[model samples]
Target: ELEALADPMRKDVSVVRKRIDVVNKELKPLGTNVQKKEKEYKDALDAFNEKNKEKVQLINKLVELVGESERLRMKKLEELSKSVDSMQ
Candidate 1:
């Protein structure tokens, strides 16, 4: 009676081990694909951040250029006003 019980239990354990092996084989490729996708996402994010930084720098330069232009125009207006006052 004990022998018969041990035999079936041994078979069940073997079957379970084989199923686990098959599942592990399937998971191996899935893990590799997940890693590949993660790397791609990271690369795309890096590129997007780099482009955003460049855009911000360009906007800052534009603001500086506009400010300088306005300052020069105001200085010119002041000089013209002084010339008109001297003439008067």
Candidate 2:
């Protein structure tokens, strides 16, 4: 009777071990995939940051050029007004 009881328990333990092995095998590839995805994310983030920096620099230069052009145009207008007033 004891042997009969232990036989079923042994079979159950064997099935559990097989299931654990299958899960481990499935998990092994997932680990590598996770690492690969992490690397891809990091590379993408780095590229985005670099592009953002370049965009900011270009915007600053544009602002500077616009300010300089406005200053020159105002100076020219003032000079023309002074000459017109003298002539009148």
Candidate 1, 19-70: lDDT as tens digits: 9999999999999999999999999999999999999999999999999999
Report the Cα lDDT for candidate 2. Answer: 0.96
Among these predictions, the greatest lDDT belongs to 1
lDDT of each: 0.97, 0.96
Supply every candidate's count of residue pairs whose N, Cα or C atoms clash at under 3 angstroms. Answer: 0, 0
- Report the number of backbone clashes for model 2: 0
TM-score of 1: 0.80
Model 1: which ten-residue window has the lowest total lDDT? Answer: 3-12
Give the best candidate by TM-score.
Answer: 2
Give all TM-scores, in the order shown.
Answer: 0.80, 0.86
Q: What residue pairs clash in candidate 1, if any at all?
A: none
Per-residue lDDT, model 2, residue 86, is 93
